[model samples]
Target: MRNWLKIVIFLSICLPLSGTADEKSGDHSKYVRHVEQGFSAIFRGDNQTAISEFETALAIEPDHSEILHYLGMAYAQEQFWNKAADSYQRSLALMPDNIEALYSLGVVYFKLDKWADAVPVLEQVVELSPHHARGQEMLGKTLLKLRRYGDAAPALMEALTLKPQAAGTYQELGTAYLNLKEYTKAIENFQKALAFGPGRYAEPHYGLGMAYLRLGDREKSRAEMQIYQQLQKEFAEYERLARLTRAEPNNLEAWSGLASLLMSQKNYPEAVQVFQRCIELAPNNANFHHGLSRTFMALNYPKHAAEAAEKAVQLMPDQSILYNTLGSAYAMQGKRREALVTFQKAIELDSEQPYYHLNVSKLYQSFGNQKLAQEHYRAYEHLLSEQKAKQK
Candidate 1:
């Protein structure tokens, strides 16, 4: 479920702590000091300390909506979800139109997987904060989870208009369209989500496959399903290896396996972190350097990618795939000559490899060398055919 419901627990220390006129209670100065300490504790990630301080503030100003809201935030940070919900409810009772209390309550309901309970609260949030992108997104996601496809679509569309590159919103919107049998719209949204390179999200591809199938495009459907299945397997492997890494932080193999799977899943940021762990564990490992290079390339950090690729090449000069990756990195950096030379080396080392021949062919075509391009293209085609024949 695309992290759509994460309620940040940053309490507003700057909020004026003037006791509400409705709450004819304790010393306003004490209430303000307690609130300040509570928010400071929340900022420090000390949820228990924050909870204690907020409780003291609540004791001083029993009917204070702001204090109640911050108390709920502290409870939420501690995963005392039911307590958080109750506090938010109390705050909302005091300030019926409070957007923060409504949104946080909706998020707490979502964290509890109470989709039914989340809808109305989230709807109120969006109604109150019409321009709030995340409020719209959460409403859409909640509706999607409830399989309210028709209602989900418009909310998701609004969210997309607010933040076009929100991949999760796109994924949920695609699923909504797919369920509603709007194949073309489903396909378009699914393709958009995938274009953002969310390889960890297998469901969007599955939705694409279903949409294509509904459109009577069996070949395209099957292709999408294949990708979905591969990503599913890789995601599972990543989770498994992640557990192993956590259990054995010093385990180089575990880190390497996790990094490789993350790379395959297109989680380039996490992949880079895990690959960096592997490098720290075994600095001279060519495979780790290669993985780092690939992840950097995926992240569009071409300079970093080229540097990592160079290290991989130096570590394993005989590896054709390393040279091919290096070539691609060079190409990404617009070093056409170096790219061509590296691609040629890869082809020389692996003459029958279709990818190497295809890369060289594309490079030749880019340079307007029609004859060389045609020759390499034919070679690529021949190799691909031979491989397919062998598979048959």
Candidate 2:
């Protein structure tokens, strides 16, 4: 399942407005100002500022459903689940059919692991908005947590229909089938999940392995189990790194390790956040900026990558790797001349770096300079061979 917090944050930001305070009311100007400020804070990820602004808004009009809902979102962002739930409950009390409030409340419950409490709220969400895919998905996950396998299967199946490529839902549905002793269906759903997520999802492989074991297919089960175990090891390492960062928020090494692991997992969004946090702790750290640049590149935000890479280069102008990263970002933005110049600077700084030579070679190739391309390519090959030989 997707992290409940992430789901709540996304929904809070994207869901259509249920309603707003009456602009024609006497206190409308004051209320709107505070509400606007609250939303601005929310967008900036300043939960404290958001909470304060929303409280001010509520003081003006305590019965406003929309402001209460916004307050819930701010509280949820800060992981203050109890406060979030209270705000959502208040919002729903004023506007009973507020689907977003209902869903957010259910998500808060799910995050709190109050699975039974989550069920009816999520059930109401799906009932009110039958086409709400995330609502169905959350309801199914809540049911799965409660071990209501038969109920979970249908809800998850509906979610899969709405979101055909949700690998997590497929994995959960496979689990439902597995526990129901429908081994073939379990294997089928798990295989579909693996096909969609490949190496990123381990749980499906474990489910598949269990299904195969039930069917007495030892070889297939062994292969799936091996993959599952390997992925589990990698996931364990990631979790350990994540825990270290949480335990020592000011520890540069811990944050760096977690950011690197997130990048390797291709989770560029979270990696960007981690890199930003690292930068916050050590603003002058060029490596954090370089990592942020790489993450932005992975996210296909070439302009952002260029900006971060430029910061990295400014902080550590002598580093060949920073120049290389800047060059790559420029190349992504179609700044061919800038890319070539930056790449050449990288080579000048460290002539023996084979990857730098390879980057220049590719750029030259793109510019139809075959002679220079081949020259740089030959240098890359020779340097790479020398490095390998030295290692051997």
Candidate 3:
């Protein structure tokens, strides 16, 4: 929670079964003797013997549900889920409706991602043994996995009511809310989840970032993204920083962002340098060249402006926007023919656009091509009329 890391997700599935050592050496009586000895040892601070003795007893009396349950418990104690599951299942087969065996089997199934299998068994256990925390938790988790969020919500809510400090319950509720796209609610629950501890949990911060971005708070969104980036930098060895620097030269954002920022600052030379760096870095980046061309125009460096504009045209020839940018750059450079050609290119890119026609008419008027000027002026007025009609 301190780091905004939500929760550590344990693998709820695939619980491994523990096995006993020195199993079944003598007769069934000897095995029973070892089992008794094992329980005595369990109480006497020797868990290894207890586990060993329990398995030895099971070997002697394979059908003894009581011994089977004990063996399963020994395996469960060691966190060996498969052996525990087998013993628990055998116990239930021998003595059906036994609540302990039912619960243990549910636990085994839950470990095995037998979620549907886990649900009914846990449901049955809860019905018989109401007010059981383990059953409720397991059922809630299984339901959560099945994406029955609405159904899972109440079960987890009940779990939190009983055990308010259970961190996993809050996390599950967060996941349910995330599934429902109730992002604000999800963020709240994820915050609650983080109260448990901090351990490689990135889900919450990312989710929060997305929510903030969706809510149109760019500052908050950026803050969360920064947090995520910081955490990612701390824990992971990534290679994006170099790539970003290479892409932007010296940028707090992409080329477009850097260009805009520098333009605002009126640091035309440094900004021009940045834009040119962008062009050098990404030779084929249409926007990069376009931005550099604009910066050169601002600096009154018409040669660089014309070069950058031509590069932008080469990169994205069909873009009417770039065509306009190039036309403007050419006009600034006193290349009347080049400017007129570029404006014509803009018109071809989008013939109904009045701006390109207006530019062309202005260019022709300056060049003393009165007939062409008049014709383009008429075209511009016609385009303006059509635009107004569309608006109406």
Provide TM-scores for the models: 0.65, 0.67, 0.46
Would you give me the overall lDDT of model 3?
0.78
Best by TM-score: 2
Candidate 3 clashes between residue pairs 3 or more apart in a chain or in different chains: 14-111, 16-80, 16-81, 17-80, 17-81, 17-82, 18-80
lDDT of 3 by residue, 99-167 (tens): 878888888888888889889998888788777777777788889888888888777877778778776
Q: What residue pairs are clashing in model 1?
A: none
Specify the poorest-scoring 10-residue window by lDDT in model 1: 7-16
What clash count goes with each model? 0, 0, 7
Better of 1 and 2 by lDDT: 2
Score residue 27 of candidate 3 by CA lDDT: 62
Candidate 2 residue lDDT tens string, 1-392: 56998999888876643333343464778888999999999899899999999999898879999889999998999999999999999999999999999999999999999999999999999999999999999999999999999999999999999999988899999999999999999999998898887557899989999999999999999999999898898899999988888888798888888888888788889999999999999999999999999999999999999999999999999999999999999999999899999999999999999999999999999999999999999999999999999999
Q: Mark the regions of model 2 whose C-alpha exceeds 4 Å error after superposition.
A: 1-135, 194-199, 219-223, 226-240, 243-247, 277-286, 301-319, 385-392
Question: Which pairs of residues have clashing backbones in candidate 2?
Answer: none
Write down the TM-score for model 3.
0.46
RMSD of each: 12.9, 13.8, 23.8
